[model samples]
Target: MLDVLAGHAARVRAADPLAGGQDRLPKPGLGEQLVEVPGAVGLASMDRSGLDTLNATWGPLVVHRLHARVGGPDPEAALGALLDAWTAAPRREPGPLAVLWPSRDTAAVRALAVRGFAPTVTVAARPRRPPAGQATDPRVRPATADDLDGIARLYEALVAYDAQFGWVTPRPSTPARIREHLTGTLPRSWAWVAEHDGTVTGVVIVDPPPRSRWIASMVTRMPAAYLGVMYADPAVRGRGVGAALAAAAHARLDAWGVATTLLHHAVANPLSGPFWARQGYRPVHTQWVRQGRPSAR
Candidate 1:
């Protein structure tokens, strides 16, 4: 298990070398502080530089973001302290308190929602199932290296969909970046496209569990997998392409023997919440991320 985490950390380092790059971020105890609790250990990575960046960008908000893995003794105390530190931090404004959790943790996740942190997004997924039917459609196939362009375009669509919130950076979403991510150490990162009469209608990207950071949080050392990042072209919105792609992805994962799969959807996206609900997914967890300057007093 440690080796797997280490490998994942390495891959992430390779992808984003600027974010501590195999030095500060990946090391277990090198973080600013390690708060120990039963069944969990909180690792605070708030270095002076990190804190300074937050203070500058967030304007007087002492943003204390801690990433803790629940594996020690008691996690509740550690989590409590982490949250308390953020809430009590001296901010010019009330700001926001946020935590990202694997959507499978319904109770703990919903608890935060009830504590005034409304859910910003809910990613839902269909657990892996056995391959019951061969993909009769000619559009969907195992993604080959040559299909990188289509995959990138697919990701662009997904990112554009996310841009409505204005949180994503306006960067060049290109094929090279998509290739780096899809071909990286993250296993089962597959893509498929829908073509009809020689024209591409939609695309789907399916990544297995444990490879995904979100899944890694809840499915650690478990015999489960996840499904994520399903997007369809807007031109084919009501043509059943999205459902077909999603169903195919589910069948692929199920054949892989993943106990369950998961993904997140924006609560803000119209009809998204209901669309997944109709597909046998429920509100398993709620995550909130409120961004603002600190109190200006």
Candidate 2:
């Protein structure tokens, strides 16, 4: 557990050099502490003494720790403290702390802004509903092993679009990779495709979260949620084809009893943000970075 925590700290440091990293926390003897918070699993790797010291010395740490515990009872007070701490800290420096939260958390969103974080990307938490106002003429069906090549082409297009922003670029899409993602028998892990007369026009893929990670984190015993890739031929952009493909993917998840879905979209995408918002999504937590200063753009 300590090793894992150390490794995680190393990753945090690598991603943001200005963050004090593990060195900010009092040394190890602080056995791992895990708590269930409102929107996420709260973990503090240091021990009680370390935590107490942090609360005493750093006003920001005090606010963060208190918020972790009693924020539910007085949300606004906790939020205020968070904002105060954020103001005291310099912007453009990597935060010594990091948190993973559900994208729907309003408090987390506010906290990010307080910490001088910016909305780097947007994640949409879409609920599963029947596809609305669309249909495909040649018809849509589950994508099988045979449709691997077409799926690869669609994934490639999606990844290429992702490259327009940020540093973590996805690999070039390929058939082998598509097959690998769909090999197992698992709920909410499936694919769908639309074909026109003698040609494939659109494709998508859905994958449920893995079981082990949830169990380890004690999130829940329930089956995981789903995410996917989507793409349609440019010629059919406004023709309801993308919506149909999305509806088909949602249908597959619903059949598997997955009602909640999550997906990442570049904040710069013109249509994607409003499209998901119309589908009922709001911002949760964002992945923020500091190039030279602390303000979120």
Candidate 3:
């Protein structure tokens, strides 16, 4: 089963160079992680002969990693069967089920759509390197403890903007929570804030990607960084605040000898999708979701 999954993963990676080149399977000793569709049990047991998919629960969220068979008999039907089995499977928790696949896997995407999955978030990655030109904005500098309040203000604006797109549910405590979280990240992580006329207008946070069993299995285990948060005041939009902040962050990450940087953004977000693309990030994995009950379309 592991070999079969590795073959599918290789195909997925070959289809897109930026892909992570691995799939997350349920940890060993977990019972019944693999489910074979009716009449496909024998085929599924043979190496590389049948489709392999992984289902796991992360907190309240159920995640399905769909694998498409290369040169399988009816690739679409195979994926559809897997989706049907996954949706009908009993769950220990209730929450949105997210189906993830390589962005280049159109067959699995079509099958997922038929199974009522809708593309939601796109995880993108890019090599860490210095921006082509130095940022002229001297206002963009390493964040200091005194800048916490300003950073929190910028985060509040970011949350408010994202709320418009249903990315966050804002509560009165949201700003305070963000400030507390940023406060903890300040000393250990690299952060920079963009200032305009003595007022911070933007902020970017960089941190080492959290190491997990899932990440350690990737074929290319290079030092990587994560863009934890990058937000600019709406009032400062289109004034190059975000670009300057990102450039500054990239310079720092590059100096740390990071090979790649990754971030996730909502595909439905009009601002984030195009903004990150302009920043040279390319979609590597796409997370499709089905909320509530599955509906055939």
- Models 1 onward score TM values of 0.63, 0.56, 0.79
Q: If the candidates were sorted by their lDDT against the true structure, best first, what order would they fall in?
A: 3, 1, 2
* Model 1, CA-based lDDT: 0.51
Tens digits of per-residue lDDT, candidate 3, 60-89, equal: 123334333332445566667767776687
Distance from true position, residue 13, model 2, in Å?
A: 31
Q: TM-score of model 3 relative to the true fold?
A: 0.79
Candidate 1 local Cα displacement, residue 202, angstroms: 1.6
RMSD (Cα, Å) for all candidates, in order, is 9.8, 12.6, 7.2
Judged by whole-model lDDT over C-alpha atoms, candidate 2 comes out at: 0.47
**Sort by TM-score, best first: what order?**
3, 1, 2
* Candidate 1 lDDT over residue span 157-226, tens digit each: 6766765653332243234455577666224575667776755567666556556654544322334445
The candidate, 1 or 3, that scores higher on lDDT is 3
- Candidates 2 and 3, the one with greater lDDT: 3
Model 2 Cα lDDT, one tens digit per residue, 1-297: 343334434444444332222322323344444443332223343212222231221112211221122133333344445444433544332322433333433433465566654555654555556644345444567777677667667665665575565422343223344445445432245667788784667876667556323312212223445455677767667776777777776655656665456666766777678766765654533444222222211
Stretches of candidate 3 above 4 Å error?
21-24, 28-32, 38-73, 130-136, 171-173, 209-221, 293-297
Query: All models: lDDT?
Result: 0.51, 0.47, 0.64
